[model samples]
Target: MNRYNLSKSTKTALFFLSLLPLQWGLMWWFNLHPDDLELYYSPFFEAISTLQLYSLAWLPFSIGDVFYLFLVIWLAVLIYRFIKFKRNRLNRFISFLGFCALFYTLFNVFWGFNYYRRPLNQQLQLSSDYSTEALVEFTCELIEVANASHLSIVENDTSAVNFNFSKSEMQNLVFEAYQEPSNFPNKLNYPTENIKSSLLSLPLSYAGFSGYLNPFTKEAQFNSLMPQYKWPTTMAHEVSHQLGFAKENEANFIAALVCINSKHKYLRYAGLTFALKYSLNDIYKRDPELFKVMLADVNEGIIKNYKTSRQFWEKYRGPSEVIMKQIYGNFLKANNQPKGIETYSYVTALLVNYHNTYQLF
Candidate 1:
């Protein structure tokens, strides 16, 4: 009897394929033991995050950005080989699948499992449901904070506040702001964590995304071209992702918490302003009359700031941007965000619940 040996490439492919089931099983087990996952598993991942940040977070540029550039070039090379070379087709396809599986596995290991952790409301022991009166009350409070902060910032000749802080400066500020437990808990603390301007900033601007975390590299990247009004809050939101708040709404909630707690006046304004926009929009969707009334109360400087932001985005609006948003929306849904992009607005409930209970305002 002759024994056939499995080729190394075939073995490699099998290893990657087996991880699919292993990952699914781990997810299943974690889901079954939610408390253990939240109490033990999630914190373990956060510690891994700290180790990763200590290793990679201090590079002058985003290591994740370089990795992405290399990935694109590699993908291009594979396509050229598949089309022009036309040899070892099965092996090439398997290699591609293997690469994808490896990336997915690393992503989950590094950051993705936090998706199944307990929701922020449950973790904080706050009420998840809010009365309409509470939402209105919180919105009113945010409006005041936004107005006050808007007035405090220095304005350029054009009447828009000059975004004076460099990206590095803002990143450092973020690191400092998050030191407080109110900003982010000690267990998830990553005081050295940082964000950078996205290497693909122009493309991200057109795609309508303000910022994102590179799960593979543990770096936060923000669109540098976005309006100044959004910079601090957007940066904080991405950092929230690094803190293991995987859900979009939870990240926004954490961002708001960090912002309101910040000593930086601009950050305070940016945070409340961002939250107010969502609260007002949500109210508008349900009651246009109330929305109009709420809008009337917003400070003139804030209104001007909003107009400037609106104008900044207006130039980028088109079919391509809309399509990009749809694709991203689907991606979020696939990752268990049932509301897709709308999940962002759901942060309002968290804001209202925290406000009603804690009276942070």
Candidate 2:
């Protein structure tokens, strides 16, 4: 026997430890060469999406939802095995670390590296800064559009809007939204029927999440518990992820673009409502009095819709949601997103800049 008889645990620990340098090297390279990555990596992501579609698209149910169920079970089994095994604590810990390393490696290879790509704003030349007055102006314009769209839906005294279109129709409509001339950097093979309602709708609702992109399966899964008005926009948001926008605010901004450009009134209303809420919230922080005035300007129908959404979600609030948010927020922070879940709010600046530039409203 050799003098240095390294055990399996020691080898595993050393191997994973060696991988850290490579990961850091990649982070350094990508962070410095994002523009170059944009030029080269777009096709890789498109291929990933197309491959996933061809494989999982035909399934009637969400592969991602099923995957999550399996993942939970697998993790539980791992924990049990670790506790029951007679191995030393250090060996057990090394095994856990090796599992994490493998997952991280797989994640980056599949889709997580998209996090290092150039941001959409830079590619589209959209500025992110605007004056408080400019934000107020955009909020006012959104209020007018939201009022008109809300009126079209309300028709009667009832607050609930009718959804006459099937899920397929809505999916097709969102697809058409991006088919027109747009600001996207590259021509994407627009995703078709790629979004699905999550099988875990009840748990997702309690977790206070509307939707998420499953990177492993390349599926856009949304919570089905929300109202129909939210369905179109949330689908658009998750599909934007499938289009390779990993950042939350960028996905939201792209979803707004897709929705507002659609010919359908419901899609237009959902997009406007999405942008208006962000703009109004930003204005509220800058000047609450102006926010109140603008809020008063919104139509009664829109106000009723907002209240309905609020009341619908309030029932699901609990400690589980708080814990979920904390875990997710930390996950985001560990990624390139410095603001974590708060990055969702950064879409307001994007909306304001876009409105000012295109006079879209």
Candidate 3:
């Protein structure tokens, strides 16, 4: 009996050990052939994600969040056992490696390969480069549209626009926003909507994330505690991930596109202002003086809304948040986003160039 158990353990460890090189080779091959990756892997992911949504979307809460909670607990137990038991240390360590190998394989099969697919701009045939002058012009246009949207919602220009709907209602609106097929240049088929407010909202806020998609379950989880004004775009961003946009910047662009094109006024406002915020930040980086001048032209109400969001995040700012962000940034860097967390702001380039052809408002 001991010999049989030992043989099974050794075979399991060998299988996992072999998977490491095989997974690496697949990733390398996909990275080199993005066109093939897009043609093959992306469609496969969409089908898999659709099935995941079909299976999980009926639940009222985030199953993905629960899965993560249990995952942490399970890992903690494993570590504790390894530390407490000096015997069978090699076997324990091998088991841990096997766990990691399985997770990596599942992650890549589910969503990681999307990172190696063709760039969204190339797929959409939008220009990838723009001059500083073009950026300024687009930013000015966004400011005008955002100001109009804000005024349409509130009586006074100085008063911030408020969402009367609760978070649950907003989630429904996000679903409705994506239902229209004509809203996007490409066919963004979103069937079986599975967005949910994360049970980890408070912890997620402390970790400095607005929302994220669970690769394993294909659930879109947003921070429920975030300011409602930002919810439309943030929710849309996660849904974009479910649509197989793995890059943060591309998801941002798609989210903005969805919101801006929606018939609902609030969604339109959220999308336009979201794009404007990124564009303004980009301007501040390129020419601070120009940004300051442009800022004055935006409505006071819109600026107040931006301040509210900043204050919410500021309340949770800490060393732990910094560390969390650094870790996530490194994860992004490893996944083909060279700019890491900063890759999000690259959405500005896409927004500006997209507007050149699409007419953002």
Candidate 4:
């Protein structure tokens, strides 16, 4: 008779592997019951995230970036070990699977589950569908507001509006904006202040990401190297993610709302123009002639600001950016956003419908 015993590593790996099914089952349940997620899980997330913010917010630099750097290095070492060593190959592969299972579990528990929350449109009581005429009306109003905001910041109609505040100042402004009583129906409670200029700004800019929220650390990381005109809204967007609006379009809509309602003129400009840019793109898709007509009415300074942003991105346009975007798009699809990266533009529907009732200007 021959006796075989499992290694401790194999046992540990099996334990983690056992968790995968439970995690998947819970995710499915949450997906089917989004209102429960919003009512229960969202509040839980807020409570835990507030604690995370308290822990990590005071640091001057991003601990989340460092965590990612170390994670990549660890993965590389694991891969090299797996490839080079022939001994205990089964154990090694199983351990890797265990690590992946653990990571997936932690991600969902900490932040990914928020992806299953009720849609922002429904929460705000805004319609998701709108006619072309309604879009044109909302967009025209947006253009007028954007032009007024641009003129308020700059002397002439031909020059781009400049952001006079530093990154820290911008973060502070966002904090103040969220604290406003009328800005959000529920108090957003942004005092912990975890927003940071990313240490990976150069690489992030190359990857075509404006900002991201770190699920593990609850820090909002914005690419510092991007054009200044993009700063306020980008910061607001990431802050929205930290506040548990996990979907990109929801974050965009929330950010725009926060900024437009801000007392700061610069933030208001950032918000209005940010909304205008998306509205214009939607119009172009639906009716190009109407798009051209509406765009021509926009102030020259706002046009120059748009051109400046385009030229900034144009400098980094390449195959790698496309690949990065495609990967992110697929990731979004896996996380309940079926339209993938197109989900970002879905903010237009929310904006248009919200404006119908609230009047954005």
User: Highest lDDT among the candidates is held by which one?
Assistant: 3
Please write out the lDDT profile of model 3 over residues 15-80, one tens digit for every residue.
Answer: 877888887787798888887787878779888998998899899999989999999999899889
lDDT of 1 by residue, 1-361 (tens): 2234445775797798779888888777776776877777776787888887778876878889899899999899888889997656776677678878888898888887877777788877787677778788788878877776776774532255556788778877777778766654333476686788899888787887889999987889998898777888888899889878889889988888887788888778777777888789878877899999999988766777778788878878888789998997897776667778877656888888777767655
Quote the lDDT for 180 in model 3.
Answer: 68
lDDT of every model, 2 decimals:
0.79, 0.78, 0.87, 0.86
How far out, in Å, is residue 308 in model 3? Answer: 0.6
**Residue-wise C-alpha lDDT for candidate 4, range 1-361, written one tens digit per residue:** 1224567777887898898898778779888988778777888898999999999988999999999999999999999988998887877788788878888878888999888888888887878888988889889888888888888989888888977778889899988888777665566677577799999988887888889999988999998888888988999999999988899988999899889989999889999999999899999999999999998999988988888888888888888789999999999999988898887557899889887776655
State each model's C-alpha RMSD to the native: 2.7, 2.7, 1.6, 1.7
- Among residues 3 or more apart in sequence or in different chains, the pairs in candidate 1 whose N, CA or C atoms overlap within 3 Å are none
What TM-score would every model get versus the actual structure? 0.92, 0.90, 0.96, 0.96
For model 2, residues 14-42, the per-residue Cα lDDT tens digits are 68766877986886788789976677766
